[model samples]
Target: MTRFLHDQFAKDYLEELLTPYGTIQSSRPVSSEVREVDLWFSPHPESTLSPDSLGLLARAIQTPAIFEPFRNPATTREIRDCLLKLLEIDAELRRESNRQVSLAPDTSPPHLWILTPTASRTLLGGFGATLDLESWPRGVYFLPPQLRTIIVAIHQLPRTPETLWLRVLGRGRVQTQAIEELEALSPDNPWRANALILLNRLKAHLERNLNPDWEDRQLIMRLSPLFDQQLEAAQLSGLQQGLQQGLQQGLQQGLQQGLQQGLQQGETLVIENLLRFRFGEVDEELAQIIQAILRLPASEFTPLLMQLSREELIERFREE
Candidate 1:
């Protein structure tokens, strides 16, 4: 229904990172035109710290704000549209407080943060956006003070862990590099797990829809190894734990679960990843083929999945 999986991923990623420090509402209605803001965040009154993983991204926002993330470079029309939504929101807030816009506190109305992968110099100059290079970074461009808006060009941001949280929302190599850093983080980090799950889903979507974009293809390739590595790591942990507990207890029960099903599930996960990696999400038609794969010996079907075409896979497993 949405244009692509990346749109949803961007919103989910921002919501998760901001959830710890604020109240966030995604796809919130704003104007009479029925425009929906991507994210509306109101910071908590007592909170001072956001998740350390977010780094500089957290430091950028210290007040209530609206965050609109674009998977593509935002155009002038899109910028004006975003401004209109911001105006409507500001009006609504002023009405709710029953206060004059001029009389209320400077931040009574939330600021609009438009985050695009890139913004051209022409667009920035046309809108009269100035970079606060002293306080903020290079990619951040501010409108005149009263307009209350900023454009964040992720690609133009500095390459550092401080910007990695924002960079993960970028395209192609930027996102891949950020994901690599995320993978290097402790496996116990919940943010990494959430991001990886979304990335896996993103890969599946790209695979299923027959994405012609080179960028999507590159992303899928980059994510494939991450999925494989994590699967192997999880399988090893399962095996080691099972063997240790089995040695202390009845060997039969331990072997039955840890050794047998652990390997099966681990292999199954890989097979599932490979299937999705190869063919996309399992449709009702494809699900039957996967069930058949589950029934077969792991070695037999695992190799087959790697080698079979979609049509060949359907013909091979449809009857089973």
Candidate 2:
């Protein structure tokens, strides 16, 4: 996959998975120069979802963090660049701490996670990155503590539940296997549907590429069956709920009005589900505009939900 496409996918995927437990700032700008952190996350003091659901990724984000994911192996220059960002953030945090006497004594800089599919021995050696197997898993290499950086070599990670989330960003066989595990997860698993939906979105983006490479073609093929399965399941579930709801309404109101209302309610549920998946929460503003968006045909509204920003969606649907 191309870097641009993969970068967007990584950001969105992590954001979707982590949003409930913390604050997420994708493409967060830093300093006067135009530098952007791919993803910055700070965990909520208390969250509904268990950290165990995300496994190792949860551990990585226990504190404030900066995540920079690479579709391919990271180069030495890229590694250094990530460290520079880390140092910059450290300085910024220290400055703020100095400015505010009330700041906690334990306040510290965010950890930097450089996520790459693979890191060659030579590359790791140059950075003096060493494994801390006692404290972390195999695949996680830490640069000296002063640097406060960790390079997660996705391919090197053990194939287990703990590694599944990060492995979803791996390439070739690794990613394919992760997808299989993700597909096998329980339907009730909170992250399962969201992960699948983001993967489906990634598949759609790959399809739009005019001349896809071999790996991109392979990824698209892998996602096809899963996409069809999710679509069918979602449709069936919606239809069933709508039918039951319509029947209940018919008993109370006129049969025609009840059935129509039931269908509308089902469609509304589907739209709300999509919104929640995309934006993490359906706040008052978003809840108010659901009916407005529902007025459009599926072809139009589906893309609107998938592609538009929150502001764009509100601007287009709120007035009507």
Candidate 3:
């Protein structure tokens, strides 16, 4: 489940990164016969379409398709076919003359980018091997230089707490370089906030694991707000269930013991009553002793009852 969320996050991150450069379209249908492209990006000005434009297109297309139980195979095939068609379209567009002058024909072909989280070994083999990186029908080329940079950037993105902290601590050595590059392209960037948040989360994890003495009473906070709440509620529910089970078992055991004691006492009272009826009266002291004997094992209590005279028996049978 968490993996699914992470994959979605990656897709969204890629989308956000590309949104600034062009008109971003997602699940866009290329033709009536084909499925929609996962994402399609086009330059606003037709004249601006160049290697850089193709590079941006490549980046947009490289985002992985998330598959689930209900994923449609036909839709997947349609999307693939649509992308192939779009690549051809991009090639034709690039070849057209901007002005009346017929310039030398741009002979480069467009590249098709496919992204998936877990590509099969076979698919990866096809990526750099059988899947031609150079020539295609469209003027767009695969493995554009700018798109390669973006791929490197994606690889360098912090995916875990440890990596986040490492990037922060090595800010001078590592992130500074990337920051400078990004700033050169877009001076006022919003990605800084996201980068900082990732750093903070990494710091928090470090504080919890490494600095036992540094207690910020509020610092033992939940990593995920929703999951943490649910975890706490689940623990409390389990504890309640355990306590109830223990109490029920205790009550059942106590009731069984109590019933046994009551039955023994009742039998002793019957014996005492019989002696009182036969011998006229029972002594108070003897009756108290006989009552105490009710708690003895039935074998012991029965043997003690046989060795008494009528008057002795009457005295032994007396009630308190």
Against the true structure, whose TM-score is highest?
2
lDDT string for model 1 (1-320, tens) is 22447888888778877887878889998757878999888877777875365776787558778888888889999999999999888788777677643534323578899989989999999999999888877898999998899998888988887788888988877778888888888877657766665676666567776534777778889988876675555445544554454444545556556455555555556555665645556566666677777788754775466545567788999878
TM-score of each: 0.74, 0.84, 0.29
Residue 145 alpha-carbon offset, candidate 3, angstroms: 13
Candidate 2 Cα outliers beyond 4 Å, as residue runs: 46-51, 102-107, 251-320
Best by lDDT: 2
lDDT of 3 by residue, 1-320 (tens): 32222333333444554455455556655443564455554434333423343243333333322111111112335434544565544445455545326533232222334332222334223333232324322211233342221111122334332223112222222434443343233323344333322323333333445433322222223223422332333334433544454445556778665455545444555445433432335677456666555556644544334323345544554532
- Candidate models: Cα lDDT each: 0.75, 0.84, 0.37
| Weakest lDDT window of 10 consecutive positions for candidate 1 | 99-108
Candidate 3: worst 10 consecutive residues by lDDT?
Answer: 65-74
Q: Candidate 1 local accuracy as lDDT? A: 0.75
Better of 1 and 2 by TM-score: 2
Candidate 3 Cα outliers beyond 4 Å, as residue runs: 1-11, 44-110, 127-189, 192-320
Model 2: per-residue Cα lDDT at residue 207: 87
